[model samples]
Target chain A: MPEMYFSDAIRAALDEALTRDASVVLMGEDIGPYGGAFGITRGLHEKYGPERIIETPISENGFVGVAVGAAMTGLRPVVEIMFMDFILLAADQIINHAAKLHYIYDGQVKVPLVIRAPAGAGRGYGASHSQNLENVFLSVAGLKIVCPATPADAKGLLAAAIRDPNPVLFIEPKALYGARGEVPEGDYTVPLGVARLAREGKDLSIITYGACVPLALAAAGELSEGGLEADVLDLRTLKPMDLTALEATVAKTGRCIVLEEGPLTGGIGAEVSARIGERCFRALKAGVQRVAAQDTPIPSATPLEHAVLPSVAALLAAADRLFE
Target chain B: MPEERLLSAYRKMLLIRLMEERIGALFTEGAIAGTCHLCIGQEAVAVGVAEALELGDEVVSCHRGHGHLLAMGGEPARLLGELMGRQIGYCRGRGGSQHLSAPGIGLLGTNGITGGGIPIATGAALSAHLLRTGAAIVCFFGDGATNQGVFHESLNMAALWSLPVLYVCENNRYAMSEPVCRTVAGGDILARPRAYGISAECVDGMDVEAVEAAARRALAPLRAGKGPAFIEAATYRFCGHSKSDKLLYRTREEEAKWRERDPLTLTRLKLEKAGWKETLPWIEEEVRRQIAEAEEACRRSPLTPPETALQGVYADA
Candidate 1:
């Protein structure tokens, strides 16, 4: 089989979803004929027609609510927010309505919707476009947050999300879209809330997701040369985190380092550290260290942006601190 | 309308009015916390539209939603228990009158935000269309909600999709002291929806029969899977916007004029003229019984524990 780019994997998953279920539809700004901004939904409009590949107005709140309503009624709508930054416009429907509807209704109603958006810095999109908001959604309950770094995981996780009974926020790393890797051709699904071991090690555990996963893997490879083998865990799903896998890795390594593209304060790393402290308190060797972006907006300058965000070097430094 | 159905309409309106009155008394006595937007004079709109709907059909209401709940055959005791912040309430007392839902009776939910339920109803209608179910959704909003951007967006989508939805605009003339004339730049609310390609009409909301007739005609397309419909019912609310509201905007004479066109009285007159003499007393007794049961339920219900306050924030657990 031919190797597929991460973006093509997403398109394949969407195509499969549309082909399998008539109720599954796609809606977003400039998504129909123009394809997606990153060309993830190319040729879907012509194949599915207007009803399934809907091109909506720029009103995020309006369309998001419509998707919520559509999802609640029976349609599994995969809505795309042009960028992760624009999701702030539809916060009410996403947070208050979609997130709480099921629990508020005592599980009587289900909002089986998927919101896909591109997240993380490295594109030089500046402060507005370059953001990792998985932490923000990690705070919200009733929502499943998935950040897939590889092409195969992207396709598998998206398929699982569309089939899942609850609402899922699927954040694809924009930096990794053009990157290519091997992916299966037939139908497949990757279970949510489960972390994947990118590489095996026993000296230290490195937990990360999205764009940081590849960087963490690179850091692990480099650390291995320095006689320190780091166990790299890719947290595919942020909420309902695979704490079991995390605890097992932490128990073996006795040290952990969290790598994130978002800010250090109130980041997902904070939540992970808190939970790990509560669960594996005695097993932890020094406190868990977080290697994340500086507490500042992402700058437009390439050098300044690189200085703020965590790179492979920063992850290596954090791991060294965990051992010391 | 049949003699029995006419009496049922009158009784439902009376029950809502009397229940609102009881809620008002309890609110003033400090038994109920938070704001209560009572649908005192707008009983006709709720009862009228509800009469034409099937048991499986859904309803999404606005802030002033007591009448909407009661009209959909919601238990007054459970609703009152919610208002009184008791665990036995519809939302486990987490949501007050403004956020109540009886999904079993097809009352999808009520929203506190003006024009919020519009999209929800549109979604519900879209769901019905997708599932091929004949269950149309009746979305109730005040005349004030007509100016909202969401209202227009939802109506346009419903029209474009031809979903099974009925947008019922309960035009009581005021959106919390802002008159319809000042709020609405357009002439008629019915025309606004009609511009969206939906078949719409204005009805005498004060007359139950007129409201039901309009609903029956509008619901035809939805039942046939043709598309959605809109109805603008010109009604009135006797009370202020909320419990803490002071009557500074409208005059006493204006309130009295609308009071004369009371929906309950109009329906009762129609029932009596049809030779149903025992209708009034029976409705009064039923209203009294419901109020007593609601009050008793409120008194006996338990309060939600503080620790469980954050329990339902997510569906994972």
Candidate 2:
């Protein structure tokens, strides 16, 4: 294992899939010579040539649908939406076609497609560009949502998503793209619908995924110093959620906090907490809490954005109250 | 040989007409759980395109898709059963009229969403183009669907990438109740595909042979990997848009005029001109027998179990 940036880990997965399978292709705007908006696919165009790494003209709806079609016809296409904000344009294809085609046709087609897009707020990208839309797809039955926390899981989860039989939405936390962590060499996969414990503790459970995973770890570190240990659970795949691991952590700690970067109402936190309240009610010593963004749109100003998104300080404060 | 060709085309168009009329009856009887859009006057377009396609070549259809499915070799009994929400249906009773699909027989899918199947068809062409599979795709959409953004996007990408897809727009004069003239910008769906640089043509959708010939010509360029082609079939739907449509949008005179140019009638005339007039009675008998058998099959099929509804949400699950 060697330390690598989270962005590079994703690139590595794409590179490996393209090399290993002829059906694998990269499609997006400026992914070729431009190497993608954030330069994640920078050198891939030069390596794989223009045909395999396709460049389109800002038509997310068209290309994502093309990926769905290709998936049905034996081509494993990995489509990149430059920013998660633009994913709304392609939502029709994803939800109506890609997600339902398999079931709609009574298992006649398998849409082995992956749509990778960078999401979340850290930079001042304003309302549309900085929002996390995982909640939009959380309830879509055929769609699988995977958010990687570490460099290792970034490569592993993406590899698994690419090889998956169903449609997968690979949401990248843009804030953590440059974060450095260890990833294995060559190919590997972190199975979907499995949770990983970022840190081991007993007093309380800190449940989170994607960008919030790192923040939960930081909060747990502060809690640990104050003689309050917490279990930080990283949910790698959110759709076919790993309830087994989630309940285990909550039942072990008997207290939990659900954290997400999306808006609070009908968000990931709300869904997870409702299930936790039902199944893990007897295991709880304290009421289940949620730390998420406000129901307002993400702002452009740094301070305002900070107030909107979940923070490590907020996680700690929530943990302190769980003890009281 | 030409007489048999005319006869075969006549049979498919007649089958769609009769089958859809049966589906309408089923809808009225409460046997059909969901709404179904009939392609009564537009059979030539679907039957013709499917006739021109190779065995492995696929056809993707829009909401008015039962014709496309049947023309592409979908079993009538199974399609009827599926529409009736029976366990022994094409989608195992989950998908109904709008979602009819038989992938193994090259009927890719029928989308409920307008303009949704355009990209899927374009992508199938892309897969064929990339893999050199030589399987061209035929996407059947309505005049209304041409206004959808994906229609423009799919046509552009298909032309840009040299994908082998034949985009057939069944301009049935109206989208539910709104006429295409009012809904489409510039009132020309044909102009849209041409602007995207695709090889385009318009044919009288009432004449099965004319549509079949146009589709055959389109497929030659597509199969050669030249690029995508567009065929605007000037057809009309004889029935109302759905089970609930009251037919208030058009005058009865207009509907009667289009009915005179009905695909089945036109194809029957073609058969008569080919000196197959004596065989018409026997052909009619064969069609009636098949439709009756299909109706019986679906009626006999048991209701789909409730638990099975939860089964297909995920392929792996």
Candidate 3:
């Protein structure tokens, strides 16, 4: 019943999880006392105490493995990697241990851990701080990848991820942290692997997630005036994608456009488009069009960054191609 | 130590030696898959440290972990089944010898990577402290693992948090073919942990009584929640590092010298001197029976079906 920004929604969800489950704890650099580099965990340390809200040193690998170990031993730990690029330091634990423990142990061990990382290019964080690596983890089998587009979805999906009995990579778009939305109070959850249809139209279906979701929505609105009604679907969970919804929408619309902020080559959009093409080959009127970033490191300047990443105009143009 | 405790320690060491020898034979016969690092000659470290632990206390072991698993009262048949890649094993054939686990026996897990288990052990100690379980964690690693960065980071965290963990370094003088002198800048591994402000001790790893006594003293602060402690057991590996490794690095004279201080033989002699009449024969027969049962289980255990490959990728989520 209250308006909440994406960051506030994360905080609310973490607070709710901490209150509901005593086993849940948060640990990361600058998460406690300083609230978090982005202030998402502000006031949590004071309320939950140091035991639950721990401030770890800058040992990403150590803390990440510690989180995995804790999760295996009945504790649910939410580890925050300060930047998405820094996750490479902890890749051994994330890829080798957390993602493979369940399979290697034959269901005997569960790495019920949630790793939150801020991704995407924006705010002049430069090349190092800005990179969309959802596809890097999407290829991994045991991990569940979720990128929420709205405050309400962030709160609901994060809550569900913490409670779910698997390792989840929850990537929060840094640019959307302050974006506000109407989020309900009290306990609420949206199941993973569900795609939300943000805007419904018959002309074209624009499937996207994370930062691209907002851009896609904006593009859908602009397309309405141009007499092309485009449907926008926000794929909140990327790993176990909502193939059912995608196929049904593409079948109905007969045209599709996949949008992603990462490089067009080997992006998640490729996999989504391929799957849709394979499933709805007979129903689709045109091949799936992709609106993605250019294949290069995110540039520092604003104009270059805009040129590289997918813009609302880019999505509108792609939708226009799909309709035409 | 008491006479009965001494005899029990001897029995445990004998069991580990026999079990590892059998495992080595299985590896030679091509019955075991993956890399198998046996703890054949380093039985005292496992038996001594395990004897010092309570029933609910936990231990995280290194790749050379058969002795550690057996010393903690693991079922020999199931362990052998695990090494043979059978579904009846502790990890259901998923984790072979290097990644074996028996959480029920307080053996948290054994890892293959050097120094990988240190942080997990630290986390387990932290969990015990938070849950008020009063259970101390015993982390066992080879001298090679001391070179890993996680070892230092975990020690610092454990000392800072005063978590209940006993860092046991089985300094076997060689990490694979490289001698400890070649790899370690500082000659002493115990001193490295001591620099982290944790209480440290160096003990004769070949002597079971000495290791047990040193472990008891080192674990006092950990049990009292004062902080963590470190023990560097100065031992030698009479065998090569793994099944494929040849003993080309060391001469036969050196191997014979360490074998002279063999933990099983020393414990047997100690038990005999303490008036235990048939200790050696009884332990030998018990170990023989265990080896036979383990071998039979290994032969009879079913291999993991290929269809269940994707199972447990996530815990029913």
Candidate 4:
């Protein structure tokens, strides 16, 4: 295994998918010689050429709908929206056509496609460019939402999403793109609806995913110095959440804190906390506390950006409530 | 085109007219629910274009799509079952009239949204081009759809890549009662695609021969992978936009003027002029019997079960 940046892992997965299947093609803006906005697909274009790695016009709705149509007509198209915010323009196709085709067409057709977007708000990219917008797609029934927090999971989940016969939204947190982790080179995958237990403890569980995974791990590390241990579970797949892993960790610790980097209202943290309250109420020893960003648009200035998003300090403070 | 081929096209146009007439009656009698968009006077556009299509050529239609569905060989029973929301429907009752599809004959679907199927048709053409499947796609949308940003986006992409697509714009004069004059820029629908570098033309949508000739000419360059072509079929809808529309937007005088040029009456008159005058009565009787049979089969079709709604939201994953 080699230590690879989160972006390299994504490129590796796309490279592998294109090589393994001829039906697989990449359609997006600036994914060719421009090396993509974040350079995740930097060199795959050179290797695959223009046809397989299509360079589409600056029409998000056009290309996204084309990908959906291509998916229906026996091609697996992986689309890249430069920024997550721009994905709003193509939401009608993603929600109306690609998501509903399977049911509406009575399973006669399957939209086997993946949409890769760079999301989240740690960078000072301002409100529209840096918001976490996957929450809007969470409730869409047929869509599978995969948010990878590590290089290994990013590669594995992306590859799985491409091969899976459904529309999958593979969101790479911008903060995690440059983060390095041990990743196996070829033919690797992490199944949807499964969680990675990052660390184990008996006192409490820190449930988080995507960008918040690192912060939760660091918070768990700090708590150990004072002899207060915690269990951290990274929920890589949001829509089909890992109920078994969530229950086991919460039942063992009897105390839990849900952490998310997005706004607290209607966020993934809200969904997870509600599920815990309903399913694990009898096993809990303390009320479940949620650590999340304030309900406001992320400011571009560094200090204000830091104030609006979740932090390890916030996770530690939420952890302190487990003892009280 | 031979007289027999003309007669066959005439029969299909006749079938679509009678089928819709029966469908309209069904709606009035409360046998079908939800919205119904009847393309009664626009049969020439559907049959003419369908006649020009070869095997494996798919079609994407709009809300006013019963004609297109029938023209592309969607079984009358399945389409009727679909309109009635029964299990025997094209989508197993999952898709009502507007969303029904027959993949067997390459009628991909009739879309629920205006201009929604343009990109999908473009994508299918892209797939055919890449895979060398030798398939072309025909997308039938209203003139009202030209205002959609996606219609322009899809046309731009198709022209840029030379994808094999035929964008057939049935300018039925209105988009749900807002006539093209009020909505489109200068009401110049053909200029949109022509600006995108696609070859566009206007055809007499009321004349089956003219519409079919235009479709055949359009398909020639498309099958050769010559990007996309656009055809603005100047036609009108005999019925209101939907079952609920009151026809207050236009006058009976205007309706009667268009009705005089009805596709069915014009095609039948052409056949009559060609010494096949006696065949018209016999052809109409057959069409009536065919629709009656379809309605009988629809009555026999089972209702959609409540439990089926939960199935197939996602493929086996």
On DockQ, the candidate that comes out on top is 4
Candidate 1 lDDT over B233-301, as tens digits, reads 988989999998898999999999999998887877787788886758877997899789878877788
Task: For candidate 1, list the clashing residue pairs, or say none.
Answer: none
Q: Candidate 1 docking: what grade? A: acceptable
Clashing pairs in 3: none
How would you encode candidate 3's per-residue C-alpha lDDT over B14-92 as one tens digit per residue? 8888788877887898878787888877899998999899978998888888899999999998898887777778887
Per-model CA lDDT versus the true structure: 0.87, 0.90, 0.87, 0.91
DockQ for every model, please.
0.49, 0.78, 0.60, 0.83
Worst-scoring 10-residue span by lDDT in model 2 chain A: A312-321
lDDT (tens digit, per residue) of candidate 4 on B129-164: 999999889999999889999999999999999999
Predicted candidate 1 versus true structure: per-residue lDDT over A87-158, tens digit per residue: 887777788778877776655578889999898888799999988877778878788899898999999999
Candidate 1 chain B, which ten residues in sequence have the lowest lDDT sum?
B308-317
Off by over 4 Å in 3: A320-324
Model 2 residue runs over 4 Å out of place are none
Better-scoring candidate (lDDT), 1 or 4: 4
- Residue pair clashes in candidate 4: B162-B227
Q: In model 1, what is the error at residue A287, expressed in angstroms?
A: 4.0
Worst 10 residues of 3 chain B by lDDT: B308-317
How would the candidate models be sorted by DockQ, starting from the highest?
4, 2, 3, 1
